[model samples]
Target chain A: MSTDTAEKYHKHTPAPIDCNNVVISLRNIRKSFGSLEVLKGVDLDVCKGENVVVLGRSGSGKSVLIKIIAALLRPDEGTVRVLGKEIDQLDARELQELRSKIGFSFQGSALYDGMTVRANLEFPLVRNQRKLTRQEVDKAIRQVLDDVGLSRTIDQMPAELSGGQKKRIGIARTLILHPEIMLYDEPTAGLDPVTSVEINDLINDVQQRYNTSAVIITHDLTCAKATGERLVILSEGKFLRQGSFEEVFHNDDPIIKDFYNYNFISDS
Target chain B: MKVFFLRIYDIYQFSLRFWKEAFLPPYEYKEVFNQFFEVGIKSLSIISLTGFITGLVFTKQSRSSLAEFGATSWLPSLMAIALLRALAPLVTALIIAGKVGSNIGAEIGSMRVTEQIEAMEVSSTNPFKFLVVSRVLATTCIVPVLAIYMGFIGLLGAFVNVYNNEQTSFVSFFQEAFMKITFLDLFTLVLKSAIYGYTIGMAGCFNGYYADQGTVGVGRAANTAVVVSMFLIFIEEMLIVTLINTYR
Candidate 1:
């Protein structure tokens, strides 16, 4: 989205990429519910083993974009390809298999409150990997919990876990499947500053450990700075600017400058 | 009218989808059993209590009318037929429509509002099998048994109410109650109970699974589920009755 005076903002927008190495790709994605357009011909790609953060205001449709990659929502126009498979071309079973390779952490964590931590962690494997033995299941659970540092919460329910712990357990459950692409929706939205940083670190840690390509959707500047290898700002249902944090943060676009200035004020 | 038809079509498709998924591999019997225990076994106290009260009041009311006609001896047969052919199943289903229907609605509705259902789908699990099929199948399986139990319990209540003064024996009471139930009557009643059970389960699951995303939406779903299921029960029973009457 280039305007006559928007040269600085447009300068940092990403260049075109070779499609073969892309882990997730969207082309001219246009979606609308009723008369409101959410994504207007937006195109993005996440390379293998890279973290891209999408920053947007509330109601800017960041969550919808995240959902599109996971095939949780379909765009009225354009294409979504994840893990090299065209999403709309797959049948139900094939789509499910594709979904298993992608882990989505929702805004509220969305852990199954009916189940305990162990059951929540075990749910994906039990439902999908039916051939896993009991010992194997237990080992997988232990390994993931140990990885997330939540081993003792095995018997506890989601209601009992604090917000930070719930988010971790949510990630743990998704991680149990060893997904190749992780979609994080507001991973650090509601936590205190310290816990938010911790979750941000955890996101980075999980990305490196699992070798996952991730799309982190958040408004938290600290999170965007910490976890994102690349950042794209969504405004007016389009990618307004893209670059590293330093590049976009220092650029003199009025909209970009005002966003950083306001958030920086809030931070202090 | 169009919206009503669309809603009906949606429910029909949902039921068919459940049937399709139910017979496939990876059937979740544990989930089915849990829902059965929740929808049927757990509802016994309410069903039994209603059965007793219905039988008592029904027999007493019929006796008063029969006494005026000098036909009080017909009490046992009349009550027996009414309870077996209609009361037992209808009452049990209505109770379910209120208790279990609302519960199913709330459970699924809350999950939908909270995004647990979406998470399950994204995790590659079929929530239809884990959630809807089990609830629907459980009701279809367990409701008929519950209706039969209710019929027997109603008879016990009638016998207790008829005894001491009228002096009807336990053996005679059951004998008369059951003997009057012809095969056609039995079939119709069982068929009606099964249909009622399916309607209640489908209504609840449909409303719950399709509920909009909010706390208010959950409440609306539960309320709407009970009302719609009760309305369908009455309509279905009327249709079944008219068909049976014409057949006779």
Candidate 2:
């Protein structure tokens, strides 16, 4: 961390932390499409203001697990609870209501291709909270855009943005609702290494500033190390190993070591 | 043939899920307006412009056949009847199935394949309400309006063609043309347009929502959505015509 950034962190008192307050919990979750079981009997818990990252190979269902936590996909079996409310049982209306409190960043920079950057950021805010005046919404939009370092691109469309810029705008749009938990799917995918570092820094800064927990899914080991305090490797449909980043990194178990060393390991 | 049947079954399931997602809503108005502007208005000029030329060219080609029987005076009524009954709605819908329907399918299919839809799910926003319902409702509500616009333009095109070919005042032409059209005929036209709109919207959304595999899956969804919806529209039109004639 830079001295300038460290000083800023020291200057601002961190938000109140509820170490034991579980904001999100998933129990024995399972999902399958046809005969392919993507996630099988997975369990996870995220505390308030925690940064938890799921790491795995491309198809190990790390992303699927996060999606289930977000309540986007229904589990074939088990329960997911967000903000202490069980989500899987909720009807569509209730699900939408729950979504406003959670910010999600898509892997592909899923900004509406035709909408301007400002308009893209304004989408969830305008839809969920219609009571905000145009000025109020604009003010918030400017703040979030500035935070993501894309204020100058407000008038530009998604097609005009670079990959890094698109991801920033996607993050800004995610912040529109001031969600309690930020969900990121491969936030740094396809970016240059320098841009990837910048995005990782931004993720860290946002988590501290907003005091929100994060559930990040990524295959990039650099990103996993840079952004996460807690790391877990997902293998098959279950968590193969999980611990603090340093612990997971230093562990010498065959699967963990093989995963770190990039050795192919067949299912035994 | 087996794949086609499986696809039909899949589309049926997709439509049911879409409907369930649509009404149970925290609605996403931005996506709705975005789709409406694209699918309904952006495609308008093409549909109307094509309808107009089709009407004019039909008149030019059929004129000789009518004159051979000395039925020239019946041309106005015949044009009006044809435009209102089937040609306008059927042709306009086929064009939309190719244009707007495929666009919807591809857009949503790409979202699905890329895991963007999954992102929306984890963020607490119901992807169905935000993505699927918005496009479906927008298309359903706007297609009928497009049909009406196309029907009017087609009549105007026929008028210009008739005037260029033979001297006839606007008042006389409308008087003769409208004489044969009853409230029933107009209602039937509107009803068919509404059904076409529903079917087109449903098919496009279904294809996109359930699109699996990868890039190839999205392409197939879009292609199949257009072809199947077009076929269904024609089949339904023929069936409606038979039912109407049988009752008469």
Candidate 3:
């Protein structure tokens, strides 16, 4: 994949990883909120440069799973290792260090409302990598905005942008850090169909361009189908199946059939 | 009742976390200055107006009583003692508790509900240090300064009343006012204002940081921040006055 943004911005090579090496590994993860068991013994892994999409309905604990992987939430029972370090064992400073290499794109885009697009993108870079000069920061911001195709919205606040534009900027903000892994929570949750497709294309574009491993959590079938190199269906706090989109859905189980019917019916 | 106690305990824990994070390096100086601008500069007009009105009204009301006793000459000294020792700091704090407290609550609450806090965390930015510490430190540092300003403005308002009634000169009015005010009174004013500022900042940050249930949570956070800060401010005022009185 040709990365015009990477070439135009300051060029630096990412640390090499074997293509088959797993960057994110989760085993027997369990989480509960009060009386509700949100995630019950789940396990998953993603190799370097792979886009693994976890498809689940609302309240299926897909978000919890990702948060655990990011160490935002502690698992009740499990081991979560990201980029070769055990997430739970790392102290605050170590966790922060680890998190710098992982970019999380929130469900609502989560751009800072008080900041302009440029400041929003600059925030992570300036905070995490404090040595970058002003010109370097501006150049990187321009490159990511260009990559996300919203260079014109640099001066606008998050509220001024359309939903699609906000999503692009959110991705662009995460990409600015040059993360080794991207965790996207519902990248196309509330956009129009056309916009959803555009976001899916952007997700794929980011994966190819940045060569970052990713875990995309969403129930949107089109998004899963379009961006997921491997797809897993999360149901009742556990993964029901994992494979290619077609393989996962090709089942006689009532649950799988129901999921397919619901999505297909809704899409149609 | 159990839930209430739990909430208090949570707030206590949250305050401890703030102290721990506050001393850590990478101090977010830019954000602290921004919050100072927000808390101090933006709030100047309202604080000034409130201070002036308080001084004017309190003096006006007290004048009839003083005249009844033929002690009208004591008005400047009495007004000075009242405004500097109590009214200025308490009223300024309550106003700020309402204004800046609610703002911090709603802003951080909205950020919490929308996952912007989580976004900050994932980006390797300490959201608590960036958001809570900066606002709390700003309020802690600025509220004392504001209270002192209010005290001065209130005296000016009292002077206006004194001048109108007795043709007193500005210097004489001020001299009379300061006659009864001890260094202890000034110290109490500063201490009380700082405590109230800390209370307001902590209440707002705690409610907002832990806000839930989406938009409704944001509104609740803002409302709770004001009520709790005001309640705590009153309690703090009473305790500090009691303690300072013993010293006198």
Candidate 4:
């Protein structure tokens, strides 16, 4: 770590957290693909009902970090505890059971193109909770569609839906399971400003309504500012700045200043 | 060389996993049935056309040669031997390796690129059971049925040509054909068709499930599936023919 990065890390490192409230806790998490080290000794804590936005440019290990939390990808070295369970030690069945408590929303929406919106939502619900009657399944699907404001698109295939609508459906599919921790990978990416704001609002609504801790991964400052209660800027493989959105962005560091200028100026 | 060996190892592991997961409980019966319809019922028209044309053309082409030798009456038996032994199964396998193999590759490759497979995983649905095992099982079970259907259709086509040329009755032609065919030939046809189907399915699914790099990768996967399935089908055909011939 550079002198500037080390100082910033020491200065902004989070204080000890209450184990009861922390839904996800990672200490010294490290991951590498081939010889390319993507994450180097990363640490993070996501408290219950807290929204932590990880801000980073492309290829900066934002997605990898979240995948680690979801146990979709294992870390090479570190302790990962999600929902009070040690992620690295879980067997296949245990990991699956743990995964049921977390939802991952991919950037592309990842809706099954062959399935209609209703079937897509019912997929997770029916698979994880198999005892639900047909009426109960229909009710759950309807409720989630309503939550995402896409109730009318219940019978339509993903190909018929617009990009923003697909993203909404993707979130609805994840939310249908009522996961305790929601990992949103670039939730507002590739959406119009208006639609992005709507998604941001939906994220906040989910946080309040479901009392779910979430990790929002994005480089979009507007989304981070709107949805995140706490923000951390990841550069290279470490969190170089951490605090509230304004606190992290308003810094003397050249990298932070450049990122802020680039986003705002480019948008204008 | 190292990458090639690693890929071979990966495919071995993938095949082993499929065998292990396929027999596990909570099978995706609905998806498997859907794949049967997709792989079998949908390919009926093409298979019928090819089978009929193959029988009619091969019989007509062989008639003149047999006539020159004063053995034209043996045409029915010769046609039966060729179709039942090799033509029907080989043609059906090649056709399916081109059609269904590519379809499976592209569909699964697109899903991988779009993250639908991972989505299935996060939804607590075992994607291997739902997607890979279902399709593989459908192909393995359904291709033989199609091949048998093709063989009968080919016989009808041969009868049509024989009737046109020699005014031979359908009953007599069929009797002559059946006289030359034995139980082992039937067994070989079914066995060859099943092996080819399994090869096609495994090739398509393995390439597709591992596809990456986006749309270009999907196209590559589809192409590789067809090529690899066809190649394996030919090799398997040769090996099975040699093995069965030893018994004969």
TM-score of each: 0.94, 0.86, 0.95, 0.95
DockQ of each: 0.81, 0.50, 0.94, 0.70
Clashing residue pairs found in predicted model 4: none
Ranking by TM-score: 3, 4, 1, 2
Instruction: Give, for candidate 3 chain B, the lowest lDDT window spanning 10 residues.
Output: B180-189
DockQ of model 3 vs. true complex: 0.94
Residues B1-248, candidate 3, lDDT per residue (tens digit)? Answer: 99989977998899999999999989999999999999999999999999998888888999999999999899899989999898999999999999999999999999999999999999999999999999999999999999999999998898888899999999999989999888889988898899999999999999999999999999999999999999999899889988988989
Cα lDDT tens digits, model 2, B1-248, are: 99989977887777788777777655667678987898787988898789899788888887899999998778789888888887888888888899988987898898888766765654445667777778778777777777777877887888887888787888888788899988877777777877887788888878888798999989988997898789999998999888877755
By lDDT: ranked, best first = 3, 4, 1, 2
Residue A208 in model 4: lDDT: 73
Against the true structure, what is every candidate's RMSD? 4.4, 5.0, 5.0, 4.6
For every candidate, what is the interface RMSD in angstroms?
A: 0.6, 2.7, 0.5, 1.0
User: What is the per-residue lDDT of model 3 for residues A136-179, given as tens digits with 9 covering 90 to 100?
Assistant: 99999999999999999999999999999999999999999999
Who is ahead in lDDT, 2 or 3?
3
Chain A alone, TM-score per model: 0.91, 0.90, 0.91, 0.91
- Return the top candidate by lDDT: 3
After aligning candidate 2 to the native by TM-score, how far in Å is the CA of B222 from where it should be?
Answer: 2.1
Candidate 2: where are CA atoms >4 Å away?
Answer: A1-17, A262-268, B1-41, B119-142
Task: Encode model 2's per-residue lDDT on A32-61: one tens digit a residue.
Answer: 989999988989888898778898888899
lDDT of 4 at A235: 92
